[model samples]
Target: MRNTFDFTPLFRSGIGFDRMLNALEAASRVETVDNWPPYDIAKKGEDDYRITMAVAGFSQDELDITQEHNMLMVSGQKPAEDNAEYLHHGIAERAFRRRFELADHVKVVNASLVNGLLTIDLKREIPEEMKPRRIEIGSVKAKPKAEAKQIEADNQAA
Candidate 1:
């Protein structure tokens, strides 16, 4: 059974949420998702993240990583073998394309393939203007009672 959700009301009432709604709609589509290459996402530091994928049969030449806007795509295609006689083929060599949605300001820093694991490092590079800054609340200075009385008396005498 497939679950379906309606975002028409949200679209009608909300503004500047099209991207979020589109992402949600895309996620709702089950056929577009593939689980061939298992992956793990881990947070290494405050703003650093790592995505590790198990690409057992894929080489560096066969894997392609691309980032467009806030979407990260990873795909692998094995070269066709002409003269391969296999009695029993168990390993999956099929082509696959996996996509990951990145948060705002998240960027792909580096990617490395080692020991059948493809690790992608990501860092959130929030602009200085966008980062939260401590705003110094200015203290309102008040005149002393004696000074205020003297000023008032002087104004009256003048």
Candidate 2:
């Protein structure tokens, strides 16, 4: 099925959300189905996340996971065995590249592989000043009468 929608009005509105618009444009260009390597992304806690990839025939030494420039890159290369005598080799034993976009302040905690599953953990650390805080609005009281009068005289002189 084919579908169409008018986007001219949105472009002309000038709302000034350039970052979101650029992200949408970039997402539209991505080919989701082309790279079929199975993977899973899960949230471990309030600020922790995990990414797991299914790599059946890959060795731990052949796989690599790295974080660079706000991007998580997972790659692997499997070399063919020397004494392979199988009539039909259906399993995928080739090189692959996978990318995951990381948010600001998010960082890689650690990575490990066990039982053909590669797990990568991540955590986001928010600064103390950035977190929400309670303000004592009602606790702030007015100054004394003498202090108020002195401030008034100073203001009048100014």
**Pairs of residues at least 3 apart in sequence or in different chains that clash in candidate 2:** none
Candidate 1 lDDT tens digits, 43-93 = 999999999999998999999999999999999999986697999999988
lDDT accuracy of residue 77 in candidate 1: 94
| Per-candidate clashes, comma-separated | 0, 0
Clashing pairs in 1: none
Model 1 C-alpha RMSD to native: 6.1
Question: In candidate 2, what residue range of length 10 has the lowest lDDT sum?
Answer: 147-156
Q: Residue by residue across 28-78, what tens digits does model 2's lDDT show? A: 664656354699999989999999889888888898888996788999987
Compared with the true structure, the alpha-carbon lDDT of candidate 1 equals: 0.92
TM-score of every candidate:
0.76, 0.69
